[model samples]
Target chain A: MKKNILEISSFSNEKLKYISGLKEKKNREKSGTFFIEGFREIQRAQISGKVKFEYILTCPDCYLGENEEDLVSSIDAKTILVPKQIFEKISYRDRPDGLIATAELPDFSLSSKTKLSDDPILVIEGVEKPGNLGTILRTAEGAGFHKVFVADPRLDLFNPNVIRSSTGTLFTLDVFQSDIKELYPILKNAGYKTFAVTPEAKSLHWDADLKGKVALVFGSEQYGLSEYARSQSDQYISLPMKGVADSLNLAMSAGILMYEVLRQKSQIDN
Target chain B: MKKNILEISSFSNEKLKYISGLKEKKNREKSGTFFIEGFREIQRAQISGKVKFEYILTCPDCYLGENEEDLVSSIDAKTILVPKQIFEKISYRDRPDGLIATAELPDFSLSSKTKLSDDPILVIEGVEKPGNLGTILRTAEGAGFHKVFVADPRLDLFNPNVIRSSTGTLFTLDVFQSDIKELYPILKNAGYKTFAVTPEAKSLHWDADLKGKVALVFGSEQYGLSEYARSQSDQYISLPMKGVADSLNLAMSAGILMYEVLRQKSQIDN
Candidate 1:
């Protein structure tokens, strides 16, 4: 251990207050850092090798095994010990495991000229809920989409809730934010076929040709895609609604569409 | 109006306290009543004719349209006008629409001998989250499964969160709660094949026969279908996960499978 151990027992500690400030998107953006919580998510983020940790804080009482010790020692990041009460105060979860970290935001950007594989790319528009955004990211990774562009996201992509709900899959994928207006041309120039998922579409989602360099687009829970997203797409598709519900949740819709893309691609491969 | 307009200006009002107490599952069950929030959900519940409203509380400051007035007038239940501050205390949402209600639990029970359509039936075993339960119910309804049996649910079907998240679809569908052991024999005796969705199952979900009377079974997020559910299923199926995520969200998996059942059945219909 580096012997720079900063003990924080009081809620009045400036560093503790600063760490708590990371909960807001404005603070995170200003600091160019985001927070990650829980054992599984932090471990996954560490293993992904994409996160550049600035600080790791742990409560001594919550330590489980040698594995956690090894994890703490392996990283070059500054490690701090926090009292259990202090940890609880900073935690968003009702029962936290007492491991938390701050890391620089993922180093990536959305550009018109960016190259993509022949596999499908996900484009989510105006996804307001962090939980929904995180679930969509997890589903995207599971369905083998290498890149997802979030257009006009209402929630910060690196919000702690998003990171937690994603099970840290957010670190494992190429997620970029670009407005739909700017993104349309980039996809078009890349020779990608864009499909917008909407309730009003006549083409059933599975019926849409989701093969070979396709872009599957989705929208928010309260509102479907904006006019720009709807009008710019090459094709419009919808999931079948045989009963009373007019739509599925945004994350559910994205997951279904991503898998459909996978299913079609797999069928073609076979 | 019967002019019984009971004013609850104080949060300490016994009835207000009682209404607030319904937030707990035990209290809801003990009182033989549950809470419903917002104008749209309350309206849907009322229009379904399945909900027996005991009281309708509205804040004059939040009333929207002639529709709200019409809806309040149409119900035979006792109506009360609560001050906005008191309404805020009883409201679950931050931005209260100014309408809330208490209603008697729907009169229904699960039995092995209950009638079901020839179409597929959905059985969710031990779903822990109220949100997931609601999403599954909404998806189940959208996919045309007229009835769903939640086997040993962790939360009540009529929980406010479940009711809200389902977009009030709970009132439109036939939902029941029973154990997997009990549900199995009922489906088997009803000439319905039981398909349990599991991560370990080798058979791809799409390749399975989803036609005729089939009970598609799922498990909770924490513990996927119990051992009894696994052992008793007529067939085991899994959604193809092509990348790093070990599994999708419970609701996402359920939604994808439900839609697949619809797609396959629709193909046969065509």
Candidate 2:
């Protein structure tokens, strides 16, 4: 590991202010950086080659864990040692393991991920909840979907809550943010069929043909797919709701659809 | 509407203290009551008959909304109008809709719900996250599963987070907490087949016959089903994971499986 060039205590108000400001999307955008915490998450971000770490901060007292020596040494980023109190102030988790890093946001373009996969692309529109967004990304990566496009995202992908919930899968997945109006033409031009998820849709997802190059579009839990999304969809489908609850959480809905896409692809491959 | 025996101000320290104490599980259990916030949630709890409201606290300045008058008038519980400051102090939500209530925890004995349904029963073992627990309940309800048994729940069902995340679906569903050791015999005696979800399981959930009386068992995300749960299960099944992630979130896994069970049942019905 690089020898620490900076030692920070909780009393360093200037540094604390700058670090805390990263919590907001605008501040992160202005600085072109975001925070990553926990050893596993930081390592995943680094290994993905998407994130460029500016600084890795750790509390020597309780930060390092088993096999973390090699993980720490592999980082080319500047290393800093901070007191436990300073780390706690910047950490988001209830019981933080003390490793935190600030990294430049990944520059993902739809053009870069064009040839990434032949399977369906997951698209989320007007997603408001950061936790839901993060969980969808984690599920997308786990389902082996290479490209996920967030159309009209209410929360930035780099928000600490999103990063934490994705468990660093955010860096591994090829995620791009664009307006649905802008994305619709691109997906159509790329010969993709879009299936919009809505509660009112008569088509059950299982009955609909999910095979081939597809884009599974879902809207925020509060509002089903936006009018623009519905207008562009090749077909409208829904996961059947049988009981009293009106709708499923966005993440669960997206997860079920992504896995269905994966399951269909596996069947074809076999 | 209750013509107010007590009007509370933020400065009423004793009243504030009692309401605030309901935030903790121990306090809720000691006094046998829990907090419910938001007009929609409180209304649902009242209508379900499962949750008994002890008191209804509304901030007159901002509490009443369109149609809320009818909802409020319907509640037979004691009503108290509190100052905005006092309402804000006990409100868990950031945008408090100015409605809060203290409700008696429903006595959800397994015996009371024994005749509830012959449909699949969702069993969650060692669930720790309130959000996950709540979401699963919401999903279980949406999928039309009548009864859910939590075996070794880490968080109490009446925790504010669970109440909030379930979107008050907790009141509508037949939920009970029981030990895994105690629950196995009960399920078996009822002619329900217990299918434990685990990563190492050989059977794919889809291939398994999920037709008649079934109990779908899921464990905490951290640790799969306990040895006791596995031992008591009739068959062990898993949701196919084809990506780098080892497992799905507890809620999502439960949702997919519950829906799968619903799908099979629908197929048989047709």
> Chain B TM-score of all predictions, in order?
0.94, 0.93
What's the residue-level lDDT of A258 in candidate 1? 88
> Model 2 over residues B130-203: C-alpha lDDT tens digits?
99998998888888987899888887888888888888888878788888887888888889999999888988
Model 1, span A140-204: residue lDDT tens: 88888989998898878889989988988887777788888888888898899999999999999
TM-score of each: 0.94, 0.94
Off by over 4 Å in 1: A1-7, A63-66, B1-7, B64-66
Candidate 1 yields a Cα-based lDDT of 0.84
> Which is the leading candidate under DockQ?
1
Instruction: Flag clash pairs in model 2.
Output: none
lDDT by candidate, in order shown: 0.84, 0.82
Q: In candidate 2, which residue ranges exceed 4 Å CA deviation?
A: A1-6, A13-17, A109-113, B1-6, B60-65, B111-113
Q: Candidate 1 has which clashing residue pairs, if any?
A: none
In order, the candidates keep a fraction of the true contacts of: 0.77, 0.66
